[model samples]
Target: MTEKDFIPKRYSESMEHGSVSWEAPSNIALVKYWGKKEHQIPANPSVSFTLKNCRTITRLDFSKKENQSDFDFEIYFEGNKKEDFKPKIKTFFERIVQYVPFLKEYKFEIHSENTFPHSSGIASSASGMSALALCVMSLEKKLNPEMREGFFRKKASFLARLGSGSACRSIEGDLVVWGKHQETRGSSDLFGIKYPDEVHENFKNYQDTILLVDKGTKEVSSSVGHNLMHNHPFAEARFAQAHENLAKLKPVFAEGDLEKFIEIVENEALTLHSMMMSSRPYFILMKPNTLEIINKIWSFRKRTELPVCFTLDAGANVHVLYPEKDKVKVLEFIKNELVAYCENGHYICDSVGDGALKLK
Candidate 1:
């Protein structure tokens, strides 16, 4: 056999792919996925873009280990034991097994890592699960050649949800919005989305700028905060606001309207933060530095009459979106003022980039 033929192959009742590797990025939701319906699916249909610059690299290899009672999953980020992440990995495995029982027949050795800092509220779940999804989907595509274009991606996203609530959005491309068919709206399979501009054209160069405000996301897990929202008295009206924002932003997104985009995105992010404030225990991600930066950006824009606007994710990180031309001045502002408070505070400037890709 030639060198190519020397590659070992397994043909068994269970999926037998030699190895699968991929990298996908974490997404910061603009219009958030707040509530869940069946299967913990989101109540409003949401959408987002898969970012390119910051992503998790994952590799899955299987060699038919002996103690395959059902499934075994191992995960790591930044080369350290991710003990807290095991349950979700197992849960995701169980979900996959529910659909394809044979995959459980073989033991899986899985390794995952994020390019960005861990536990820093970077939405690692989004990209981490996404990379895993692609890893699994690659094996699926190899084992089951008949799989269709979007078949594996969506299914893997649904499976990724079992790993983390925000993770489901990571499996697709840029412009990933998380929302699903509202039961009230008479739809099932209602969760994260990369909705194909149903009524208008999709923006080609959608972009964002991320400033790592702090590395202290351990303060509140999105999961805990999410549960708080569910029981809050204003949850219903708050969710309704998310829905309304979705409607307002979707059309502009399709049209690639930047002004409307800034308006709606800022409002949606603020709306999410507002909920965090009113939640019984009352959580807040914005610090003095956070607002100072925000005020400065708005002040600069208002003074110079520039158009850039800022938005915040669940954590203290801030995302500023503007035309690519503004990158120089924007970067200078961050380098000078934004990092003054915290020694570790840094920023990565990224624009809307392409979706996930295979490594092996």
Candidate 2:
């Protein structure tokens, strides 16, 4: 749907005070979207696996105020007031106010927390922003009780994208696609949509074991990385490759071709890091242990003939993906061989999930 389609009609109803809460999961992109256009539009199409265990839970409480001149809000994280986070939330409210329209009408208290460590290569913004977006949409739904389920989800994702581009995908589950691609029906740059075609059973409940190679703040944030793509020497070709990779995955997904899936996913991960290294002011996000873990994963897969493979975000951590049937063997291998590469021997075991949950 177009951006205009997301703007709601003028509302006649009003609410004095209320509260809403939601939990939204993080996702791992198989076909990475490394660059973006203005308004959080992705430069190329990408698909991801929505994760179950790593997520953010957010609660929003709203009360009517006498003055409706400016947006009013207080933010808290894990039961503590977070002044540093206000700017991002303020910016988000500003971006979404045009569509939600009720931001200026009430004072809001937003309490949020993440199940996993923040800024630890886990795409916390995707889950955090999506959870907050779902809470805001709940308030909107209260104002217009007639809003359909489909529209609610669509607009929630639409608003989430304004907060973080990949956040659009966190609103749905299992497999979600963001950015417009010719091969993906009903895909849009405005938000993410579930893969419309049949997905092979092989992909269901797919496992993603994230190895925490480093938990510190990234040397280069995702925003800076995305901006680097504007004049990047290989930006055009990289964008084209994402589209081509996404297209290639369709048949592989449908046919349960794990070998082809591994090829595309691993290549996409390396390609992402390659772009970072090739930028004008080049930087590498991967740590030494990150490479070690990857090499170990490759060796183990080769020796065991398992469907295990690794993907990297824009950080030092590694996301090890494998089918559910191989979970027993994969987890054992990870603990015995790969855990040494992680920070403090920390890692998260997660699998595919079915979208966000409304807590209240």
Stretches of candidate 2 exceeding 4 Å from the true structure = 119-121
**Model 1 alpha-carbon drift over 4 Å, by segment:** 1-17, 80-84, 119-121, 181-191, 198-203, 341-343
TM-score of 1: 0.86
Model 1, 174-262: lDDT tens digits are 66666543322321243354655543333455457777677764477777777787678788987787777777865686676767877
- Model 2 clash pairs are none
What are the per-model C-alpha RMSD values against the true structure?
6.5, 0.9
TM-scores for the candidates:
0.86, 0.99
The candidate that wins on TM-score is 2
Candidate 2 per-residue lDDT over residues 202-304, each given as its tens digit: 9999999999999888999999999999999999999999999999999999999999999999999999999999998999999999999999999998999
**Model 2 C-alpha lDDT versus the unseen true structure:** 0.94
Query: How large an RMSD does model 1 have?
Result: 6.5
